[model samples]
Target: MEQIALKAEKRDISKKGTINELRRKGKLPGVLYGKNIESSPVAVDAKELLKVLKTHGESALINLELEGEKHPVLMKEIQRDTLKDAIVHVDFYRVSMTDRIEFNLPLVLKGDAEGVRMGGILQHQKRELSVKALPADMPEHLEVDISGLKIGDTLTVGDLKMDEKITVLDDPEEVVISILAPKLAEDTEVPTGEQAAEPEVVAKGKEKQEEE
Candidate 1:
């Protein structure tokens, strides 16, 4: 994974009121901690942080600045305002250049499957795979090639290979993606008109029986 050099400074003041004030001033409230480091409250811009997320995605390495020092970090988690799409809280984990960090790497499918070319549909069961690796050795994502897959062919975890430094957390037998024949897809939705007409037909049949 490509690690970009980004820095955020510590915030001297912190409180609910201060956070609200900070957001009003176009800043985001967050904290940086983990490993052998003390927790530091920090504030950054909402727009800039979002840009970093969009550019680097989940495989981002954040470099936090405190008192002229740079802390190599990763975004561990984030809390957001669901309605407004605003970031409410952020968690940053400090990582060592030598130690391995566990992260859920996204799975990217490359090359159209031969099955799909033959009118088959590709189904993906997992979007991300958990793995542990050194920060410098972390993969941005695992790419699975599906070029030769035919209809009913499934790509499972066992078919995946990774660098020696990376350890996949999921079971090797788990299915990741599969090519399904279009005819095999079953429609499970009920027909609204059929459902609405069934009761009237039953009522009419009962009325006819009573009259007879």
Candidate 2:
């Protein structure tokens, strides 16, 4: 919920070549818009943006310092280059601290499950949850403890302990994680002595009939 300050500058959105040139100069192209503000093209230092994201994560509120004004915003979308895995563009949504906003919150699992130690398979069913919270009440991520889970045990959205200020939008019955029994190898039967002898007896009976 801490607001991190980032410097941004207004950019011209006239040509694709200009956007490419901005990226070449180590600047990332982005758009800033909201209910009260008009859509505007902006640019920020690519390295600085990455550093902020790495340190505080995308859930943290950002104070975008543009010209002499600062806009309270959230990182809405991030586009990346498929091959190079580089950030290409970003979208910033200006928000009010008092208004509630909905977004997907990442789910992080902690502690090794007891069932896993007993040869059980641990399945992570949900990686994120839809939540609605004020900007100041939002958390970076939700952590679920799995240390006490036994085989065939499941954790659902209803089991999550959340703050009173935040509301989870997902179905309460949706499963988040589960510990399953490990698959056992099929048993291969070895023929008994009598069973093996039965085939040899049938072969000898055919030979005797042919001799007769």
Candidate 2 structure quality by residue, lDDT tens digits, 1-212? 78899999999987769998998899999999997899999999999999988987877789999998999999999999999999999999999988999988889899999999999999999999999999888888989999999999999999998988999999999999999998765345667789879989999999999999
Off by over 4 Å in 2: 187-212
Q: Which prediction has the highest TM-score against the true structure? A: 2
Per-model C-alpha RMSD = 4.5, 4.1
The per-candidate count of clashes, in order, stands at: 0, 0
Question: Against the hidden reference, what TM-scores do the models get?
Answer: 0.83, 0.86
Per-candidate local distance difference test = 0.83, 0.92
At residue 39, give the lDDT of candidate 1.
87
Model 1, position 6: C-alpha lDDT score: 60
